[model samples]
Target: MSLPTLHDLHRPLGSTGLTVSPLGLGTVKLGRDQGVKYPNGFTIPDDQQALQLLAQARELGINLIDTAPAYGRSEERLGPLLRGQRHEWVIVSKVGEEFDNGQSRFDFSAAHTRLSVERSLKRLETDCIELVLVHSDGNDLHILEHEDVYATLERLKQEGKIRGFGFSGKTAAGGVKALEQGDCAMVTYNLNEQGERPVLDYAADHGKAILVKKALASGHVCLSPGVDPVRASFELLFAHPGVSSAIVGTINPVHLAHNVATVAQVLKQR
Candidate 1:
């Protein structure tokens, strides 16, 4: 079968007016290798390798890139690597979670949110972030209600610092809440887990965007013990019209190409 390219998988990001490829490049592996949940351990790639991967992603026609402050030096590294090619990518970053000394902490106050965004701006070397998600600590409701992060994101959007904002949440209800008030939500959904189906439904019905995090169960899926994991995972994910993209963090250029090919096959089948 002739495979489709990443450009063929491009879709609109809800009402945000941003277009994204169905396969977004996640950069966690590019920065932090400690305290991760990956099935296998890997080394953080050097600048040369990182640049090659970024270039491969663009060549594959990917446009959305996901990163966060809690992802160690992810934003920092992206700053210089993505400098000259900034216009070709839609950058998605987050705030409210900080990783320090191998420990994680949360701070969602408006002041901290502003500071965090400023730091991200400096680290990403971009004047305005295309999308910003609230990096939730799994306490989705409490953070959505009690914290000032969402309000702060709205203020940033108005100030032209961020074009749009949403939540990288842990619960279906939280995703619903965020979309009802914000621009998008990043949820987890794969063969091993389907609890966030309601969130996808909400997005489809409401014309809001939903990005799938852990769409491959963080590389833990083994459906039926025979299926190609990547193909199976994406077949289910892209089957949904609401999913704008799935963020897969891999430093291997070959693996990245395989993923884009699999997503293309799934789209062709659809």
Candidate 2:
């Protein structure tokens, strides 16, 4: 079956005034291959292969692309690879977390946040990042209220370094709190995990954008015989009007095409 273009999935990302495809391509696999949570280990694709995968994603109508400093050299590689295609993508990157030496570290301070955004800008080779999310270290409420991260992001937003900002939070309460101070929240919602539904509910009522992370449970969602988990997951996710996009990471063009096709099928049936 022919897959739909991203135009078919174009929708507003809440009240941010940003339009995004229903599915976003995540770039973790393109940058980071070590110490990942995927069920199996795999080789990270070379730039040539990565470029092909990205081209396939764009061809499939995916406009939103998510990456972060923690995703190894993802931000750096994307900077060069997405040069001419910059305007065609709603690029999403993050602050607060860094991956080095096969380990992860967190730094949500205002100074670090500023530096991170600046670094992301240089690495992405873009004048402005469409969205910059606080890559939470699972301390959702504490970071939202007590930390200076959102304030820094707000300042950056005002300075036009970032077009939008939000939190990839751990808990529903944290997601809600992040929304209170930002434009969107990246929550995890899939067939195996629905605990973040309340956050989606709040986003719906408040007209805030929501970009779903781990939408496929990081490829851990299991299905019974005769069941397709991708179709099931999208059906549940898009059923909510608040879901702006679901970020799926894959280095395989076939899987990317299948996912886009599945999204089309689910939306069509609905």
Model 2 lDDT, full chain set = 0.91
lDDT for every model? 0.92, 0.91
Q: Please, what are the lDDT tens digits per residue for candidate 1 over residues 1-270?
A: 654478866889999999999999999998898889999999999999999898888988999999999999999999999988999999999999999999999999999999999999999998999999999999999998888999999999999999999999989999999999999999999998889889999999999999999988988888676779899899899889889899998888778889999888788777
**RMSD score of candidate 2 (Å):** 1.0
Cα lDDT of candidate 1 equals: 0.92
Residues forming the 10-long window of minimal summed lDDT in candidate 1: 1-10
Task: Specify the highest-lDDT model's number.
Answer: 1
Clashes of 1: 0
Given candidate 2, what's the lDDT at residue 269?
81
Residue 44, candidate 1: alpha-carbon lDDT:
95
What is residue 220's positional error in candidate 2, in angstroms?
1.3
Clashes of each: 0, 1
RMSD of each: 1.3, 1.0
TM-score of each: 0.97, 0.98
